[model samples]
Target: MTDRAVAVRTAVFPRDTATVSRLAAAYHSQTESEKVERALTDGDAPLPERYAREIAEPATAFHGRRVVIASVGDDDCGMVVVAATPTGTDVSRLWTTPDARGHGVGAALVTAAIDDAAVPVRLSVWEWREPAIRLYRRLGFEPVASWDDREKMVCLERR
Candidate 1:
């Protein structure tokens, strides 16, 4: 008798620290300039140290309460991290490497994150980024708040 193998397509969990680090580095590389940073609507302000504690670390604690979607193909395309909050789901970060733009990966990742959300969703972005703002609007995210000298714009999505 011969043994048989089953073909299954499954999601692979990110495990390598270096891979995560490289993803972070790739994410940062896209934001280091004014054009991209300004597009975040998050003030284009310098990233505070707390952001790393609250956003970057892809650890057990994060995975426990949040859902992360990585739009990877050909390379790491983009990533979205959404954490459950008292009011709703908070989009911690929605980043795409420069190499990943114009590929619809960002939109797909955002959709995945929202679909995975346990509740209503909310996210803050930079106002100067017309493309992102338009994308969020298309996704039903309406403005809820503003911060960072009016550069940061927060949006919400309700059931």
Candidate 2:
């Protein structure tokens, strides 16, 4: 299919559990790299690896409790997951493969999440993730705080 014809759908279920693991692994790899960079400069270990370890084996099921995976029809274009907490909606993870960048998949997924957010929504990002930061800005999320333990930044939008 042409790029323009490609579209993203929420609630993605992969044909096999292995595919979910691979996608989750890829997601963790990218985010963990950011965490490692923060660790080197900011003096804390990346938490994702530890977090992944504690959650249990078969990480996919644990992840499903808080996040939803979206797909580009058949291709694994990207995935985003959010958790609605008492404070706000936490955009836990959002990623698009390198090949899917600039194709509106990220924005679409975020838009869907924002629409589903409960009252006020909050999301965190590494200060260095300019593309995601930019997308969040475009989607109406504004910086509200900086976190230390997470080594990332937070943004909020109240609907």
Candidate 3:
């Protein structure tokens, strides 16, 4: 499908559970091995349960966050979660299914998140995720800092 054919829209929590689950799984699978191992060693629940709680419980610190979903035709292809912080909006999660990688689903979701945000938006990506970094750059995000040796923070400000 063409980039123009994708539909991006705000997500409704429990109503979008299936879509969220799929995207969450995709995100989990792509996580750096070190982080995944750390989570496991810390006794965290399995990835699926952790993601479910993140989406379902306000106390999990996702209460007022904004979520966006991107779809092509009837298939949910990607999702993004933007949280309002004291400094700006932060994209906590952004994931696109493998099948949707080249169809602009990630870009569409990020655009929806930024358009709906109330402040400047920022996000962190693994330094090794070159494709995602390129996408963020294309959308006008510039590196603001290095979160660690492995992650770089990027931001997009209102013009």
Q: Candidate 2 — which residues are off by over 4 angstroms? A: 10-16, 37-66, 152-154
For residues 1-159, write the lDDT of model 3, one tens digit per residue. Answer: 555588988777667766776676667666734355545323344555666575455234356877788899898888888888887678867888878898888888888878757666777776566888888889878776444344333433432
Residue pairs clashing in model 3 are none
Query: Over the stretch 1-159, how does candidate 1's per-residue lDDT look in tens digits?
Result: 111221111123455344444555555545545545445434555665544543366554255544344544335445666667776687746766665666676677677778757666877765566777777888878776443354444555545
Residue pairs in clash, model 1:
40-125, 40-126, 41-125, 41-126, 41-127, 41-152, 42-126
User: Which segments of candidate 3 are over 4 A away from where they belong?
Assistant: 1-4, 32-52, 55-61, 147-159
As for model 1, its CA RMSD to the true structure in angstroms is 7.8
Highest lDDT among the candidates is held by which one? 3
lDDT per model, in order?
0.56, 0.64, 0.70
Candidates, ranked, lDDT: 3, 2, 1
Candidate 2 yields a Cα-based lDDT of 0.64
Candidate 3 accuracy as TM-score: 0.75
Residues 1-159, model 2: lDDT tens digits: 236534545443343345445656677777667666667433344545544642334345544434444556677666676677787676756877788788787887787777767867777777788998889898888777554355455555545
Kindly report which residue stretches of model 1 are placed more than 4 angstroms away from their true locations once superposed: 1-16, 35-47, 52-57, 60-67, 72-74, 147-151
